[model samples]
Target: MIFPPDLVIFDCDGVLVDSEPLTNVVIRDNLAQHGLDLSIDRIVDLFVGGTIMGVQESALEMGADLPEDWVDNIYSEIFEVLADRVEAVPGIIGVLDALDAAGVAYAVGSNGPHRKMEITLSRTGLLERLQGRIFSREDVANPKPAPDVYLKAAREAGVAPSRCVVIEDSVSGARAGKAAGMVCFGFVAETDPARLEPICDSLFADMTALPKLMGLPQ
Candidate 1:
């Protein structure tokens, strides 16, 4: 974060809100119901860094002929659960405030669909800060690990990819940021720090530390 960022891009789920654990738990349980029986740790390692399509493809590889309504079903269940469990990531408001005080622009870039973002970010009280500013996988041809979403986000923000600083919670997102030429900082509070060590320019588990990395006064 020593570099002054022209734009700051946040990946919504784990980076901006504490939804990953809840989401992952649901995923694990749902897969178990599908007769997959994978542990939560295994689920995180296998799916944390990929798109829903990738997840579905992995399911297919696992011998699951997922019903066409499978993804929608999971989404419905996740939203219902999240309504009661969702919360912003600890210390993120301070980071957002610091960025605002420094006059830095930031936006959310996620692999989630619009409705998911609407439900989660809204419930977490982040919608007003980012409503129209959010970008999703539905906006691009390819999701994370492909650089499509990150590149489009940077382009729309009118900043060079090199001048943007991306905050990511997964290896796929870190790779996408790097692929888009942005420096990515990995948030490893809930995920194994080692997973993103190779791609993230820096790794941090606390949200309050981010503004300092962005060269903002702490």
Candidate 2:
């Protein structure tokens, strides 16, 4: 089936940028400093595509008495490492160019904090392509799986929810896009495609297939 979406929404960490492994590494390293260490898979399962506060809350629930300032410290460490290592996902630029050439408007809707989002996009050279079109979880009362971010993104992009398509790599993000009434296409990068397939309207094995899948004048 052809999906003629007016606006294409992208998730940042695992979708647009290849930063999920880095993020999990940073989180694990920082937490280890405080005597709290988590496996990367656990981190990915629990924190990927979740808000900062939500992750902190989860950490607390997991028995870590992280102070209010812990989030700040984690951010600082993550950004310090990210500033030097973050890069765009392979094929992202090509996909973006294809979308632009097709005149399909797109925006980023992420559950990450504003600073992290800014730094990742800027350091990876994606900021210019996404300027004025980035929407963070902070922009809404709730994050992914709540649909607020995607709903707001669609509105800001001047497209109705049904006319928008969301590209995501996490279950939370895909769920949010579906809840927002948009077609959700899962981009399986580091995860198993079968795991993401059921929740996603369609699954793209790589970014190279996105334009065609979205019916973007390919």
Report the number of the highest-TM-score candidate: 1
Colliding residue pairs in candidate 1: 1-213
Q: What TM-score does each of the candidates earn?
A: 0.96, 0.95
Model 1 segments more than 4 A misplaced: none
Q: What are the lDDT figures for the candidates, one per model?
A: 0.87, 0.85
lDDT by residue (1-218, candidate 1, tens digit) is 34679789999989887888888898888877776878888888888867666777798789765788888888888888888889999999998899899888899899988888888888889899886789999999998888888888889989888889999989889999999989999998887889889999999998988988888866
Weakest lDDT window of 10 consecutive positions for candidate 2: 27-36
Instruction: Tell me the tens digit of each residue's lDDT in model 2 across 56-174.
Output: 88878877867779988888888887888988999999989998898889999999877888898998889988999999988998888899999998888778898889999998898
Error of 2 at 202 (Å): 0.8
Clash count of each predicted structure: 1, 0
